[model samples]
Structures are given as C-alpha cells and as structure tokens.
Target: MLRYLSIIFCAATSFSIAAQGVVTLDSCRAMALGNNKEIKTAELKIKQAGYQRKEAAAAYLPSVDFEGAYTYNQKNLSLVDKDQLLPVKTFNPLTQNYEYELLVNPSTGQPVIVNGTPVPLQMALLPKDALTFNTHNVFAGAITVTQPIYMGGKIKAMNEITHFAQDLAISMHDSKVEDVIYNVDAAYWQVVSLKAKQRLAEGYVSLVESLDNDVKALVEQGVATRTTLLSVDVKLNEAQIALTKVNDGLVLSRMLLAQVCGMPINDQFTLADEDKETLAETTLRPATFNMDNVYAKRHDIHSLELAVKIFDQKAKVARSEMLPTIAAVGAYHAMNPNTYNGFANKFGFAFSVGAMVKIPIWHWGGLSNKYKAAVTEARMKQVELDDVREKVQLQVNQASFKYQEAYKTYDMTCKNLRVAEENLRMAQVAFKEGVSTSDEVLKAQTAWLAANSEKIDAEINVRLCDVYLSKVMGELKIY
Candidate 1:
C-alpha cells in the first residue's frame, strides 16, 4: 500500500510538471504566423516575386558579352594559281610502263608508252576549282556591349507590370496571415466552449449525487421507497457518463487547438483564463464598411485589380512585337597560322560599329494572332476584376448577416441560462418541502445542464462569427 501511494504521488507530480506551460492569444497568433505551412509558403512566394520585380526593373540597364574562339583551315587559296602543283616520274611498279599521254603526239597516233624505261612527266595543270581564301587557323576574342536604345516603351511597361504583381503578392501574403489568425481564434474558442461544457457536466453529476444521498437517507428513515432510491442512483450514473463524455471532448478540443497553433501533439499547454473571459465578454457586431469601399480596400480585391493592370501592360508588350528592334554592335579580332606564334607578329585587330534594324516583312499571321491573344487575355482579366467585386460583396454581406444572427442567439441564450438556474433552484426547494417528485427534480437538473451547454455554445459562436465577419471586411487586424 505504501509503494502504491508513492507511485500515485510521482504520477501526479509528473502530470503537474507536464501541464505547466500556458499559451496566450498573442503568443498563439505569433507562433502560427511563424510556423504554419501555409503562411510560410505565402512568404516565400512574396520573396520570389520581389526578386522577379527587381529583374524586370533592371531591364533598362546595359548588357555586356565576351566571346573567344579558335579555328583551323587547310585548303587551296584561288583558282588562278596554276604553279602550285608538282609532277613526278617513277618506276613501273604496278603497270610496268613509263607511260605518257599527250594531246598533240608527233610520232604516233597515240601517246608513247615505253615499257621498263625511264620517263619524264611534265608538271600537270592543277584543278583550278579546288581553292579557297580564308583557309588558315585563327583565334579571336572580343567584348561587346549593348544598351536598349529604344524598344517602343515595352521594357518600361513590363517593369510597371511586375511592380503591380509584387504588390499583388504582398496582398496575398496578407490574406494568408489573416487566415492563420482566424484559425487560431476559432480553435481557441472551441477549447473554451468544451471546457465550459465539462464544468457544467461535472456540476450536474454533483447535484445528482447529492440527491441520491438524500433519497437514501429518506429510505433509511422510512419516508422514501427503495424504488425511489434506485431511480436516484440511476440518474447519478447517467450524470457521471455525461461528465466522462465532456472530459473526452475537452481533451480532443485541446489537441485541435495545439494542431492549429503548430505545436507538437504531445506538448501540454493551458490556455489563458483571462483570454477566455475577454472572449466571453466581447460583443458581436458588423464593422461599418460599405461594399464599394471594401472592394477598394480588401487585399483579395486589390490583388485582382493589380492583375488587370498587369494584363494591360502585357498587351502593350505584345503590340510592340510588330515593330523593329534596333541596336549597335562592334567587335575586334586577331588571326594566326603558326602554332608557336603568340599575339605579336600574327595579330590583327578589326573594329566596326553599326546600327542594325530588322523589320519583319511577313509571317503567316503569327504576330497578329499573338497580339489578338494578348488583347483577349486583357479583356478576360477585366471581367475577372468585376467577378471579384461581386464575390467580395457577397461574402461581406453573408458574414454580416451571420454576425447579427449569432449576436441575437447569444443574447437569448444568456437570458435562458438565468431562467434555467432559477428553475433548478425552485425544483430543489420544492423537493425539500415534499412537493416535487425525484423525476421532477431530475428533469429540472437536466434542463439546467442543457441550458448551460447551449449558452456556452451560443456564446462561442458569437465570438467566432464576429471574428469571421471582421476577417471578411479585412478589419480583423484592426481588432
């Protein structure tokens, strides 16, 4: 028995140590923003867009390129060089003939062919077609730079478009942050709601246990039947079962809250009691925001507006494709034929600067099709902007109506809780005076528990819906 007591004491101590940490509302919000996967992804996208916008803005700057190459060539120079060929006379190793064929033979009708004798073969005329000019090996290097002289304002338009896109990315990041905030709020409120229900369940169990004791006392004094005492015991058992269910629900609610706050599942945390009290006292109401004003102010709406602007700039870039691209180019080079020679004797430098303008004479209507596509996409984005406006207004209206409905429900439930408490008090008094049955007292207790549960749910929904409505109006951060 002493060993068992020591084990129990150690377990209690461990539990207390594990459950010591607490999380406040502000801390939860900060951790969610820092650790939530969705928010982290949004921040990364914003950073990527920032770099892309910088790249687009840097398009007006000059660009420089360095190139080097080596080549080898072995071929004839020109067709007019006739003395470049050489002839030879050799022994008759294959045909055994000192043979010669001449067009103008003086002593015979055919060219003379003397077998096994020395012969003189004159230099033959070389084939004039096998010649080239630029045939020697050469190595060249050059550094060229080009600046955007004019691009029909396409570069500037693209820069403007990416600037707007960066703003849209930032707006999207803001929306993700808001979503994280809403999740934390809802999860924390759920935990609070379940805790309240658990308290009510425990209270019901206690009341039923007390009634069971009283009925047992009356039975011992010959004032109550055994059947009545048994009924009271059954009610006590049912209350205990309800209390167990509530405890399980509270544990599950706490786990959910931890998940939303991006904490480890095994990590124990207690929510701030003051925060729950403040949430219970907060009023539910719609913010004063006009639909027209919201369409201009909300990040989601503004992101789409910026999208339309980007498409407009894209259309300009597409139109610029029909015009010519002009730029100046210059280069210098050196050539050498000897393998051992360096840049001294075998070096020659040449430089020429010129403006090149390439005009597209015709295509199979490719340029026209691209320009049409750009125009179509731009108009489609315009329609999308209008759609976003309609959607935003609908969401705002729905959230506002829900806020009002929840507020009214919360108010009614508060009044009902008071009535339930009074009813339970009167039923207890009547039972003590021999004017109420055990069933009547049990019914009143059940009603009070239900009323308490409903009030807790209604109160939580009011605060939750208020946060939702504020998120819709983009006023959550202000709160």
Candidate 2:
C-alpha cells in the first residue's frame, strides 16, 4: 500500500510538471537551448573555459600561504683539542735559557725538569654531551606577495591564450545552437507537413466513400453496370489504403517531433492551426548571404582561430622554459634541543630579497621537440581554416540553389493545382449531364488528388529548403 502511494505521488508530480509546459516552436527552441544535453554540455565547457580564464588572470595577483610543520630530530656534537698532543717548551728571553719539561721518563722512571723547575705533564679528556630532541610543532603564517616583475612575455601570452579559449567556447556553443535549431525546425515542420497530408488523405477517402455510395445506389437502380460499381470499389480501396499510409506517416512524424522536443514519444501532441499556416509560409529569400561574409563570420572559423592562438601561446610557453626565471625568497626557523638548550624554544627570523637566474644549459632535445610540435599544430590549424571556409561556401551555394528550385516547383505546383481543380469540376458536370463516362470522372478525380499531393509535396520542400538556407546563412534563430 505504501509503495503504491509513493508511485501515485510521483506520478502526480510528473503530471504537474508536464502540465506547466506548453509546446510551441519558439518554446521548443528555448527549451532545447536550455535543457538539451548537448547544449548543456557545451555550456558547461564554456563555463570551464571561463574558470580557466579567471585562473590565468589571477596569476598576475599576489599570493599568500599559511604553513606549519612538526619535527622530531636528534643530534650529537663532539670536538677534540689537538694542542694537548703537541710537546710544550719554555724560553726565558732575559736569561737566554730554553728547555723541555717532562713529568716522567719511560726508560729512567724519573721526572725530568728544565731550568731548575719540574713541571707535571698531564692530558685532559672531555666528553661533549649528546643532544636529544622531542617533537616540536612550528606554526607560522606568511602573506607572500608575488608581483610579476618579468616573465619574458610568457604570462601575458598565456592570458591571451585563455581569452581566446573562452572565445572558442562561445563559438562552439553558437555552432551547437545553430545545429539544434536547424534539426528542430526540420522535425517540427516535417510533423506539420505530415499532418496536413494526412488530413488531405482523409478528405479524399471521404469523397471516395461518397462516390462508392452513389455507385451502389445506381447499381441497385439498374442505371449503373457491375463493372462501374467494381471500379468505384477499387477506388475506394485505394483511397482507404492511402489514408492508412498517411495515418502511419503522421504517427511517425509525431514521434520525430517528440524526439526533437526531448519528450517521450508516448506524449500526445498536435500542431496549432496557426503554426501549420506559419510553417507553410516559411521562406528564406529575405535572409542575406554572401560566401565571403559567411567565411568571415562562421563560428567554426572563429573557433579555429582561437585554436591557433592557443597553440601559438603553447609555443610561447615552451620557449619560456628555455629562459631563466628569477624569484626572491626569505625564510625563518626555530630550533629546540634537550642537551644544547635544555628543551627550550630558540626562535629566529631572517628577511632577504634577491634575484635568481636559472639558465637552461642542456636538455635531451625535449624543449626543441615540444616547440616543433606546437608550431606544426598551429600551421595545421591555418590549413584547416581554409578547408572549412571552402566547405562553408559550398554549403551556402548548394542551399541557395535548392531554395530557388523549391520555390519554382512550388509556383508550378500552385498553377497545376488550379488546372486540376477546373478539370475535375468540368468532368463532374459533364458526367452529371450524361456526356462523360464514369471512368472519365474517376480519372479526373484521381488527377486532382495527385495534383493536390504534388502541391503539398512542393510546399513541404520549399519550407524545408528555406530552413536549410537559413541555417547555412547562420540566421536560423534570427528569423
């Protein structure tokens, strides 16, 4: 019972969430831009680049650190006096007497004196005590200010690279948005077109059903032959089949729309009447396009430019490794030893500032190799930029040509639809006046339906090609 209640509660919450959302083309685009996984991932990369840029900017600022350490060390100190081992002599300058003194003679077993005075000979032995140290914790805090005196332009170059990376991220995001907008427009319009086709098919089927009833009634009245009734039956069957096909197509189109909206296919949805009309009238001719402008403004091109900048900066950073980096440093420390200072804290502090230069003397060709690779990558990006520009030009040209063709087809189809309508009307009146045969009327009706189908197809193409052209021109969202 509790599990069922929990399921019911979840279901209610989901329904409430879904009820708040209204699906429109603009709304769908906004939702996809905000919530689509791909777009969201791209946005996250942009954020990451932003943080990296911030980190690069922060490099120019001062830094502070708090450090603490606990040390337990033991040491012993010993010293020997070498002066005691050497022989001692006494000299009297006034008496001019010089003599050596010995307390005992090994062979004579007697003391020897110099200058009528005996001096005792002795050796002194001393022991220096060993020092033991206990654990001593040292806590110190220092505010270190690192003002970049010079970095051989490496820091500034890196910051520029990071800024370029941020720009690249933004461009990538725009590229993804363009792609999503195009895809969604395709799906949304496809579903709308399919729905219109389905309605047309249903209308044809209804007309066939009415004709079938008339044929049956005529056959019963002995005015229509069995062959004529059979013909009408065949037409009815064809119309039913066409309707079935269109219904299936509608279902599929709805599924695709759901996919674009990032919703479940099981969700029930339909296009608004105004949306259907608006989609039918979509055109791209008003959008301005120039191959040169497109090449200059393409997001992909901008992204590549940023990539080249980053690679160039990478080369600069590598070159910086070969130059000397100078820094000034100062330190202070305290010591405590049991034997030396009776386990008392001896504190000391020192302050000094000096420049240091570290010259790179030799490497196993590592720096050279890295610099070479960076240069190669930067060069490759330049070639890639050209290739992408060519491709973008081709896309724009192709889309423009296709749009023109679709427009022509739409115009021709409109004229053909009017002719088919007149032909169908003339055939119906002639059959009613007992001049044209049922077969002729049936043929005219078939022609009219086919013409209508062609017009619908042409219109669909016109709208789709317009979307394609708009996308190529980078104006999918703008218009």
Candidate 3:
C-alpha cells in the first residue's frame, strides 16, 4: 500500500509539473517574437530610419550658428606724419622794419630776403610717429543665420526619399516578424506530433507485453511450444526498445520547441493539446484566393514599391543638383578695437543681411552624366519591383498547391489508420481463438503503429502547410 501511494504521489507531482509548463502556440509565437535577435535588430533599423527622416526634414528650416575668436598681434600699427613749414616773423634791428623769413636753406645756413629786406625764414619740418594700434588682446564674435530660399527641389526630393526609406524599414520589419511566426509554428507542431507518436509507442509496448504473458501461460499448459514463447519475448523486447527510442525523440522535440520559444533548452514542458478532429474539419474547408490582390499584402512587395519611390526621388535630387540654388543669409558681428565705424579701440556691434545665388556652370558634362545615371537607377528599381511582384505571385500559387496536396495526403492517411486499427483488432481475435500465429499478430501491430505514426506526420504537415499558405498570402497575424 505504501509503494502504491508513493507511485501515485510521484505521478501527481509529474502531472502538476507538466500542467505548469503547458504552453499554447500563440504564447510560443509571442515569446519568440519578443526574444528573437533578428526581430530586435529589425526594430532598431526602424528607429534609425526614423532618425534619418527627421534629419532630412531639418534641412527645410533655417540654420543659426555662433562664432567667437581671440587673437594677439606681434606689432602695433603706426601712422606716418607729413612734412610742414612755419613762417618766422621778427623785427630786424639793422633795418628797423618787420621782416618775414620766406625760405631757409639747410646747406647755406641763410634766410632768403624779400623786397630788399630779410623776409620770414621758412623752416623745414620732418615726419614723426603720429598714431599707433594696441596689439595685445583682440576678440570677435558673430551669430549667422541662413535660410534656403530655393534648392532646385533638392531638399524636397531628399525628404521624400527619407520618408520612403522609413516605409521600407517598416516593411522589412514586418517581413522579419512573419518569418519568426512561421518558425515558431513549425517547432510547436513538431512537438505536438512527437508527443502523439510517443503515446502510440507506449500502447504498442503494452500490447506486446500482454501477448508475451499469454504465450508463457500457453507454454506451461503444453498448449504452445517454447519457440512461441521465445518469439513473443523477442517482440516484447523490440517494442520496449522502440518505445525507449520514441521517448527520447519526444524529449528532444520538446527541447527544440523550448529553444525556439526562448526558454531554457533543458527545461521540460508540455504542449497544449490540439484538437485533431477540429483541425481536420477546418483544414478541409474551402478558401478563396485572390492572386491579383495578394502582392499588395506581401511585405517584400511593399518594400520594393518603397524602393522604387526612393529611386524616383534620387533622380529628382540628381537633376536638382544641376540647377541653381538660392539662399538668404544674415549675420551680426562684434569686435574689439572696431575699425569700420571709426578709429576707436572699443567693442562695437555691426550687422549685415544679403541674398546669395549659386548657379552650376561648366562641370565638364559631369552634371548631365549624373542625371542620366540617376534616371537609369530609377528605371532599374522599377524593373526590380516588377520582378518581385511576379515572384510573390508565384510563391503564393506554389503555397496554395502545396496546401492542397497536404490536405489530400492527410485524408489518405486517416483512411489508412482506420484500416490498420481494424486489422490489429482482427489479429488479436484470431490469435485468441488459435486461428493465427504470433508472427501474424506482430505484423498487424507493426502495421498499426506505422499507420498511426504516418497519420501524425500527415496531420502536422497539413498544419504546416496552412501556416505556409497564410505566410505566403501575407495574412498570418500573430499577436
């Protein structure tokens, strides 16, 4: 009784653990999307694109800058003095009249006489240093503002290109999300399929064990040969080995699912039970496909469309580069020892406003060639867009066909499972009535196991095909 109680307790603990670890498909997809490295990188790309768009928009606004500088000169500036003359007037004692010295010769040391009397003597003057500049500390500061009046549409085109690039990043992020969902779905379904196969393997082992017991009893009663008992033992051993192998596979499959869901790889978990009958019923339901509108739903196609728009903007930008640009500029400057107003050695403020125009002149045909190259690139992007549309349609069609095929295969396997179950039942009845051999019973059991395994695979395939089809159609939504 104690042993039985202990077994029950252990069973309950395991069940509780499994119950706690149970996860749904949607939960796995959400976890993977949150933890996937690629998804995180794509999100970062979107943010970068947003920053670039803002940078482009900034070009449309006026720019203001402040500048300051200080300098020291080695020598002071000086001004030269001009030559001058002065009249000398004095009363001459010998002549007793007022005389003015008109001229004086430096070499002769005599004054010239005017009207028979000594006139005023002219004295020569030499130049002397008059003005000087302070060379110690010079400082200047300025605030300048510039607004682009006309850039030949270059700024507008660049802004549009950035906007288109942002859209492209969003589309690429969406595409990455879809890929993550598909991978999670595949791993989740694989775990489910392996669980089902493990159950079947356990059942097979039980059946073989029962057959071995019956054969042993028959051999003791002389109703069956020892060889029969040995044969049953061999089948039992093989079944047990197969069960062990299946169990290992199931554990690995669960681990794989855990890894995909960003959980600890060694952590054991239970999958939520899937309703196979309901899945089959839903899968068989008819669905309409609108191939014409499918391309619009594809993220890749959206990305390509945005690429074309970006290229178109590039062409406009290149052409604009060949045209003239115009701008309005204003500046307010102050400097120590201001010289523009006067010869004052003090700080003074001055302001100026003006307009500027830049025209593209001779460039050795460089501008024209660049414009032509841009046009060619735009055309190339258009071609790529067309190709992607075609490819998206093709992928959709192929996925549709594969879905159909998966459904048909699942149906066929379902029928096969029914037949195999009935065959196993008949073999058991015949073996009890002594109308069949142990070998025949073993063969039936094997066939039944094979059929069940195949049916599980078929079911998983159908589900995966559904996922693929939705992915190709761009209709898969995992929240």
Over 4 Å off, model 1: 1-20, 72-137, 274-280, 284-288, 334-345
For each candidate in turn, the TM-score is 0.80, 0.80, 0.83
Q: Which has the better lDDT: candidate 1, or candidate 2?
A: 1
Q: lDDT value for candidate 3?
A: 0.81
Using lDDT, give the best candidate's number.
Answer: 3
Pairs of residues at least 3 apart in sequence or in different chains that clash in candidate 2: none
Error of 2 at 287 (Å): 10
TM-score of 3: 0.83
lDDT of 1 by residue, 309-383 (tens): 999899889877877777776655445532234323365666657677877668889987898999999999999
lDDT of 3 at 303: 88
Model 1 per-residue lDDT at 434: 94
The CA lDDT of each predicted structure is 0.75, 0.71, 0.81
Q: Give the per-residue Cα lDDT of candidate 3 at 282.
A: 41
* Model 1, position 337: C-alpha lDDT score: 37
TM-score, structure 1 vs. true = 0.80
